[model samples]
Target: MNEFQPITVSRRSSREEREIALMQIYRQVLERVPYSYERKAMAKAERDFLSDKIGVRRFLKELGHSRVYLDSFYYSSANLKFLELCFKHFMGRAPLNRDEIRDYCDILMKQGVHHVITAILDSEEYRKVFGCFTVPYARQTKYYESPKAYLESDILNHEHVAQRGRAVPTLYWHQLGLNCEGGVCITIEGENPALQNYHPEMKEAEAPQGTRIQQELLELLHGLDAVEAQRLVASLHRKQDRA
Candidate 1:
């Protein structure tokens, strides 16, 4: 909303801290806001939040139901665009793909707006990521269990919405060899984003926990010379002996 201020929030934050956090939530959820207080619904939601009547999740629920949200994101925008916007606002990433977009559209068409909100807010993913007190933020791929989550998150989080100023699904053009980051995106050899933190793949099986542990250990020992590795091993042995 205003640059990117760091919001160090927790369940135990003071009222003033929570108020500041609410500002961020408003900016994120109501991307097309007039003034928060100027809107009767927004004002009431804020009051309920500040007075301890609702948590950040519920505040988001109310905001999603606001006329501003319905008018701008749901009514005016295409369902595909609306789906991506909901992911961004509520779940903090793009829909995994066209299949997800269709599923959400079906929900909206059959169930209604309240169900749309309930589905996301009540989802296990939502609870695990944002919980009750936390405000949803642009989540990283690792935060999700879906193998496709990072692929979509990496591809979309860096891009602006309706970048063409046309409301459409984020993947409306993905089939046209949009490629991906790291190995997925076919770019000039050095031009693709770093493989360490940002990468893309439609989906992948997670390595087993034991394999992950081994990989972590390998990472720790990667650059160590023989003597250093010996010393580290010896140190660990000593610690075990003490235990």
Candidate 2:
């Protein structure tokens, strides 16, 4: 991936340039896996991105849910291990702390894997790092809090199944100094800003009326089909006149 270099696509970019962007985009998302020719699952997504009908973010969502990714990473790996891989591929890091892992694990258990994939791609951190049109790459420059993020990246971004198995997080081992030959390991922690407080399911009873409405709205729009989503959004506009 050339130090996870960025080959961004713009509306003004030439066809050949966008094509190159497509190649690198796949490399960045799928890692060292085969992202061309054999990937019939991603054919429509490929066409949309090439024609500028979809941005890199949307393309990434497709790639994240593709059967290749599910077979290679999701279904094969446990929830924690899968979360670590998603962080490396989409967000360019590992679990910052136990809470971060727990939060995603919560979402994974409650909402299913596809939502977890979309949550990472839809994060504010993701928007800040790669935005809509730019490709996501495992680059350290985007992460400055700790240099170990790169090390964690290396651990989580592998094509081989994580040696830690599906249940344990890579960060836990890194904390215990199992990932390296070190005397001690300090904590590497960050908040759960990515998933918009996806932890602790704030369903009907738990959340107050206003928060409950927001939660319900979010749920409604999340995984809906196109026509249904459009209709619901229109109804929301007609109904929710608040800021």
Top-lDDT structure, candidate number? 2
- The segments of candidate 1 whose C-alpha lies over 4 angstroms from its true place after superposition are 1-11, 32-38, 143-151, 177-243
Tell me model 1's lDDT, rounded to 2 decimals: 0.59
CA lDDT of each prediction against the hidden true structure: 0.59, 0.61
- Cα deviation of 22, candidate 2, in Å: 1.9
Candidate 1, residues 1-243, lDDT tens digits: the string is: 346434545657788988888878866776544464446657878788877778888888887887867876677654455677788888888877655666676687678877887799889989987788887777664356465567667656565534422232335424322233321223233432221221123122464332333233333333434454334323321121110
TM-score of each: 0.63, 0.64
